[model samples]
Target: MTEDLEALRSAPVLETERLLLRPFTAEELDAVAAGEAVAHFAHGFPSAEDMDFARESLMAGGYFFTESVYARLAVVEKSTGEVVGTAGFVGPPIDDELEIVGSLAAGRRNRGYAQEAVTALRGVAFRDPAVTGIRASVPEDNAPAEQVLVAAGFVRRGTPGLETEYFLPRPA
Candidate 1:
């Protein structure tokens, strides 16, 4: 599906009660993918696994505002101006649906940052009109992620266990 690259490029900065969600610049994405420390981050950068994921996602060429519903945003804490995590759509919408992806820094978890980030992303997705809903898949062992999704109003939609899928419909 062809996407409006300009729209993606012009993606807005989203603000929540305690967070700011800003799209990642190509350079920043590259830096993260290379496992280098990003400037202005109080906490350390994303994990090596996350960097690998970012690299693979970038190489796939449809995430990060080129031709997909991507928004590789950095989740920043409003108070300290620290980058606390990463959050956004996994890729372009498929069948008008997309998956929400997020990861808080190891030290930033359990403080409700993930839920706030996901909630803000949901607002951004629904604003587009093309997005009908958002989904998230979490490993069964990842209870924290499940709680985050649940707090954000995502309900489990299928068989529960090892890998569970959750869905949240766009509000009318």
Candidate 2:
């Protein structure tokens, strides 16, 4: 895990017109998990919920730092040069499929930032060629998240339990 943390320093970055989906440095991930402020994070960025999620993911296996399409990239607003959220794959491809997750600071929502970030992530995943499909799931009532995935070209799959699933296959 320590080596993974060191490797995270050089993780690839994906950019969009208005956002940069950059991987979090180990230091930034540490700060977020500890609920401490990172210099480049926007006000209210990495909300309490985000902090908890980071901590949980870190303890699980540090997969976010793996040298693969799986990563927890910070979603930075290019104009402000501040991190407004995070978007990334849940882990390396499983059976040639990967799952993605994203979240934004309260103030950043509804601005199409999430859509842009997810689109960037989707492009990165497909670039690997080994990835055949990408998936994301939103809570049943989270219309905005569902819309973001749809806008990124993810098709509605089905409701599996309390969450609705969306999937985007590699471009033909």
Candidate 3:
């Protein structure tokens, strides 16, 4: 993934009225991977050994970057510029399709940041001629996030209990 890392390191910064999405450096993200910082995406702390595996993978840059995915944006706060979360398409699983995924600071939910941030990322995704739609999988219990996705135009598509999927078409 050396090529993906270099491309991610070179992509342009994305901006919104209240957020800045950009390529995350190891310095910007080590805390999240190291378990030193609190994260809202995972259900619980991983075992220490799991954290170590993740730390090494992140430091080596095995993950796909935005440009490589050609759509995902690393969510950052406008004021602190600290990465508060991740928002964007699935980085590597597919390229022509963008699977929207996001998580905000636990204290920051219900404030419409997810919608605002997703809206901005949508702008980026639609700019690519090859991308025609975006999708997000939200748990059935996550009524708030479901609302945000609908407000952003995603509609329920499928899935069992914890895996319901919603999809929204890319704007012309």
Q: Against the true structure, whose lDDT is highest?
A: 2
Ranking by TM-score: 2, 1, 3
lDDT of each: 0.76, 0.79, 0.64
Write one digit per residue (lDDT tens) for candidate 1, span 95-168. Answer: 88888887878888888888778877787788667789899989888998988888888999896567999999
Candidate 2 residue pairs in clash (backbone atoms < 3 Å) = none
Cα error, residue 50 of model 3, in Å, equals 13
Candidate 2 local Cα displacement, residue 98, angstroms:
0.9
Model 3, position 6, has a per-residue lDDT of 64
Worst 10 residues of 2 by lDDT: 3-12
lDDT comparing candidate 1 with the true structure: 0.76
Ranking by lDDT: 2, 1, 3
Error of 1 at 4 (Å): 11
Error of 2 at 104 (Å): 0.7
Supply the global lDDT for candidate 3. Answer: 0.64
Among residues 3 or more apart in sequence or in different chains, the pairs in candidate 1 whose N, CA or C atoms overlap within 3 Å are 69-92
